[model samples]
Target: MSKIIKKIFISTIMVSTTFSLLMGAESIEISPSIDKKIFHEQYVSVTVKLNNKNISKVLIVTDKNEHYPIELTTQCDNVCSKIIKLRLGENSIRVEGYIGEELAYEVKNELYCASQAFREYKEAPIKYKERFFHTDKNEKLCAECHDMSNNEQKKVAFVDVKDSNCFVCHKAITLDRYAHAPSANWLCTSCHTGEIENKSKNIIEKSKFIAPKQIASACFSCHDKNKQSWDTKKHKHFPVEAGMCTRCHNPHSSDNKMFLRVNSSFLCLECHADKKLSQQIRGNSKCPGEQKDGCTECHNPHASDYRFLLKSPHVDKKIDNNIKGK
Candidate 1:
């Protein structure tokens, strides 16, 4: 009887040790799903299915340092969800886990926001129709952008030969970088048609398919451009070639010269944030807002034709003026 009691006590101790070890080695898993694009709204909804427990806190943090508390849809499990308000451009959403006031781990994702309406086929919003004035009028001609008949039967394939339909309206597309591959050969469908869903951030929803929503991935698919950790130029403006194409150039329409959103001078100032430098650039010690020479006066916005992306070589200003006049 004494031996049996001793054996039972040892077994209980082993079971308790095993249970504690299992509890201590807690692992957390989160499955996040996002809609990539939100229609006419500033906020996007995210559903995060979590396989975690003992989470003292779970918060959704944005790139702008805005924190939003995530609430579990069901207490029975860790399925959580939230609606996050986003800025105009790229918005990074990070999920942070905390255990009893202690920081645990963080998972991050990204989504984009734009007032640009891409969905006009199934449900045409008044604003979207107004924006694409021509496309709205030509709504009868489905073949211009999509195939209404089952002859092609593709989920998102466009009419093959009429790929230049976009060019009909956007005649001013800049040939910068010699028309990047995806844009070349008019295989617009390859980049425009969605692999799974017929919706992407950049593409207007047509049939059952659309282009890649993420601009960078759509570009890099054939452009061979990769994001580098460091900028190694004589004068590198971080945003240039930063895969933020729409920042400076209209992706489809070359409304502004050089495919620029605005002239380089004015565009640069938007982020330069240095009033003194703007004044100095304009040779104005008094009024910075009034520019004497735009950014092109000295700096080459695209490349360094002269040193440090300068527009001209270092020479006496008077001499150059005299030479030009002569």
Candidate 2:
């Protein structure tokens, strides 16, 4: 009986040793991401997809053994993923996998991130689809589109992708389906030259285009023919008063009436706060009783163009106090 017990113990030890030797980091794969710029971005998304189901636990170990557990989801049968955020510059990530707390495999890789937006090389532009035939063929402006006898522009033969150059061929934005009054009348200098030319934008370098504006006054330059300022309105939509014209209206032209980015009903409810209350407040309009059709059923979006923009008779006009009013 004692000999039998000793034999069984010896067999168990042999099996455990064999299993350890057979266990390899073969099936495990660690995908690495290349260095990327994160200019004006919150975080550099460094995703490392690990493929191996045997790994039950994963960790992203950075410098100083700072272990961050990787939260993974199954993409397919044998794939796991987690996005890791790293600061700018050299990052050393050590990925380790475990089978129920026992370290099974490990992978080491180096990655770099940058917060600057400078590129040493860029792909040459071969696809210039914007070179469509111009409708107006009175080509008197030579310097506008072409390099006049090599005045030493960056590209001698090719027209650089500049808005000033674009106007030479694409001057017909004003003739759009629903052209803006300023654009249709060829009044480019008002908005583009005075406002846009001075503004800084994504390039962070000096350029001709104006920086995009957020203040309402920029759009009010032409949109409100009455020259009525949002500040002076008795009742103003939050976005309109805030000068977010681009929120609802398309910048150029649209097939939709009034150049709306989307249908009015859907656009209004996006920020109206309460959907059920909005339906009650809007009341039944000429619309065919589709409650989901939203706030534009009766209310004129820009202002109280629809009978003083008052609350619907269906809605109990109440103030912030939440008390019902007539």
Q: TM-scores of all models?
A: 0.33, 0.37
Tens-digit lDDT track of model 1 for 1-326: 69999999999998886555334323433332342433333545554544557676778888889989976544436555566667665567777767778656566665555533221222332332211212333333334333432232223444453455543322223233434333433445554553533333344534333333345555545444433322344554444555444455544433356555555666666566584375677663554224555666656565453454565565335446767995
RMSD in angstroms between candidate 1 and the native structure over all alpha carbons: 17.4
Clashing pairs in 2: 196-210, 199-211
- Model 1: ten consecutive residues of lowest lDDT: 125-134
Minimum summed lDDT over a 10-residue window in model 2 is located at 127-136
Query: 18-107, model 2: which lDDT tens digit per residue?
Result: 466335545455532222222111122333444556678778787657677866654334444444555444557666777777776766
What lDDT, from 0 to 1, does candidate 2 have?
A: 0.47
Give model 2's TM-score versus the native structure.
0.37
Off by over 4 Å in 1: 1-187, 190-235, 276-293, 305-308, 312-326
Q: What C-alpha lDDT values do all the predictions have?
A: 0.49, 0.47
